[model samples]
Target chain A: MPTLEDDDLVFRFPQNCGRSTFRIAFQRTLRIPDSDREYPLPPGLGTFPLRHAEDFPALPDRMAARGGVVMPMWQAEALWINCSHAGRDDLPVAVKIAAGKINAVTGEAWRPGLHRDPQDYVVAPDQPWLDGFASAPGQIRQFVAMPLGDGYTAEEQITGQAEWGGLQISVTPMKRAAWDRLRKAWWPGLGERVAYLHDNFDRMSMGLGAGGLMRQRIEEDPHDLADWDQRATERVFVSLVHAAQWSALTGQQPPTAPPSAQAYAKAGLPWFQHYGCDRPALPGASPLRDLFSVAELHKAQTGQVLPGSQDIAAELPVRPFGTRPREVRSPGGW
Target chain B: MQRSAAPSFGTHVRALREARAVEDSRFSLRQVAARCGVTPAYLSRLERDESPPPGAEVLVKLAHELQEDPDVMLAMGGKISDDLRAAILARPRLFADLIRALRDTPEHAVLRILREVRDGDW
Candidate 1:
């Protein structure tokens, strides 16, 4: 008579209504050594206790005495076993399992002891397990067998998942100084590369459009639009730069800048003519006359320090630009 | 068989109350439950189809509150089809993670990506 109290294994199954149902049952006990507080089982062996019924009731009394309960299968959806807390001095922690099955058809109700593994059970591939695996390594391994899914390769399956996955199943200790050094050295370099790509390839060449198209067509097609857009944008920028370089070497109008700079001068910023051409006449009633003064523009355009230029800079408060207060608070303060 | 679509619990409750309007002007279940000195949960359960239909005295009280004939609200409650259970289960989560990912990403980047994606470049 294995009651709920004695159960350490649970099974999850689908009901006729397409809903998940859970079941609880007892499983065999583990004989933990007194010297070793935590035990690490070989890969695949972790799920073995769940497969059998006869082994449940016969589990060692010591394990059952410590409140070793099994988790309900549905709760095992994204299960990660952390052995770090076991047998610490503060208080003895116990592993307890709850058993139940979800109704497969209606996705409702819990039933006692019938569980189905994804391998043995046929579920729509879009189940949460599969969906989650798209961004993470989804692998199940035993000492002898290793199964892999998306985000997993043969080398990763063997080395990352099998050899190291559960071997060091402890919490990682953190050192702030070491972490800061690593972040400073690595992150900025990475950010610089990302920023460069964003400016030159992504923004300048319009690579982002490709990314959007790819996502919209992901289900229908699997192609790298980012690469294509990158190439196209690069070509355009290259051509423009090449034309400018040629003009600089041959002393011709560097087509791209001349037109845009001309437009700016016509619009109002006559100072923009300094880039490659002569300054245009100031417009009537324009603030440029009052702001620049003849001496100021001459000094700015010619790179000579005029006495009046120093006076203007001094009068302008010398504060850096873009430091205006974001919001003005009331005197009383809310 | 293509399952016949059934109304939701809220919809069914509204329909039943409306149908009994002629016979009982104030025939709502809340007033009847109050008059009988019973908690609203009990009346709510009956209206939601979670419990069996109310007794005659409860119905008479409901009819007085609604100001309708006693039998009208009762008849309307009985007209509730049992097929509603399946419809409730058919609704999907609607928005998936992909939509969330799109919404959460920066707008400028999203526009750029969409343009490239639309152009069949990616």
Candidate 2:
């Protein structure tokens, strides 16, 4: 139950690309037990956990990796202030405030000064605690601090990083519809890739996906999962997505490639070649040997010969299973 | 079942001083500390809740400097009644450990424990 001090007001703004800039403006004032000296902040300045800070740094990377940036606006741009009484059984309520610029075109700043009128509102502690403080009336609203980090899933990671004093704020102007479309298109495929790795956990001994090792260990021993019971499996999946997306955005090479033929051979799995006319003798052919040959895999998977050549479809398998499947109509057509 | 109010005599004195725009009125911590006969660091700590309550004499002196009533300062600290204690206790973190334990428990088990605790009707 720490009290507010005058010096606690900290303002942070981005120094890089205009696309990444976000300003955090707040003032900390002491609340006397029964004083007439009341100061109510405007609705624009009241939003808790402002969105600009959380969305900026990761924007450039997201733009490059995911075609267009996906910024969660309404959910990400709120501001919050933490206030709790000392030695109280009740939890601290983080007051959420709504903030918006008077005019984005004018570029004006909000300077702290006396206001003749201010909006008054009361905020409950936790979402559930809202019931207890139903009758309480005050200009200040309360909010609960949201815990966030690596352990949280992508959806759960929406919470701010409180300890760093870094508010999870996003300043991007990307509309919700655009962001939703991008995420919808991107996530399903990403989930499939991650699921593939998880299913073939034993075969995946190396690579960025290998970090799933911890997850594999948890799945191996149910006790491990129970140790961190509050966490859900979706949280783990989110962490993997964050890790993979982060790597992709940063352009850092994945530590290892998907399991190679050698890795499969080591695991005592048969190595078979499905395509390519220049098939080497089968006696020593190992899947690990062909795993690194991306050029051949592409040719094999597509059933399309090299660009400059005139190889006909007759040369390849009549109906290659790996090639794109024929579009089928729904069984229950209108 | 009401508990006695805890003393917040210190916060009262500071708040009154702030309201009067006493000292430099520049909103600088250093100016306020100098006017209050204390070091800047100590004043900063007092404002941030790092130190315990300041003395009555100091409170009186701060009230005088701010041109506010000493009694007003004392009342603001909740020294006049025990209601303050109940209010403070009701604030968040009063049962932080218990809340955290409940939150950390397995979701299924937590429901059962909550049911038992509620059924016990404490």
- Residue lDDT tens for model 2, A1-334: 0111221211111111112211222211111111122222111112111112122354333222212111111111112232222111121121222111111011111122111112111111221111001111222211111122211111111111111111121111222333345446655663100111122121101111000000000001111111221111000000011223434333433221122212222344221111212222112112111111112222454675323122121221122222211112121210
Error of 1 at A180 (Å): 1.8
lDDT of 1 by residue, A1-334 (tens): 1112111221111111112212222111111111111112211112212211112343223222222221211101112221211010111111111101112111222222222221111111111111001110121110110111111112122122211111000011112333244346655554100111111111000000000000000011011122111111110000001222333333434222112212222333211000111222111111111111222223444676422112111111111112111121121222
Where does candidate 2 stray beyond 4 Å?
A1-334, B1-14, B20-27, B74-122
Best by TM-score: 2
lDDT of 1: 0.23
Q: After superposing the true interface residues, what Cα RMSD does each candidate give?
A: 31.5, 22.8
Give the CAPRI rating of model 1: incorrect
TM-score of each: 0.13, 0.15
Candidate 2 overall lDDT versus native: 0.25
| lDDT score of residue B54 within candidate 2 | 67
**Stretches of candidate 1 exceeding 4 Å from the true structure:** A1-59, A65-141, A144-168, A191-334, B1-122
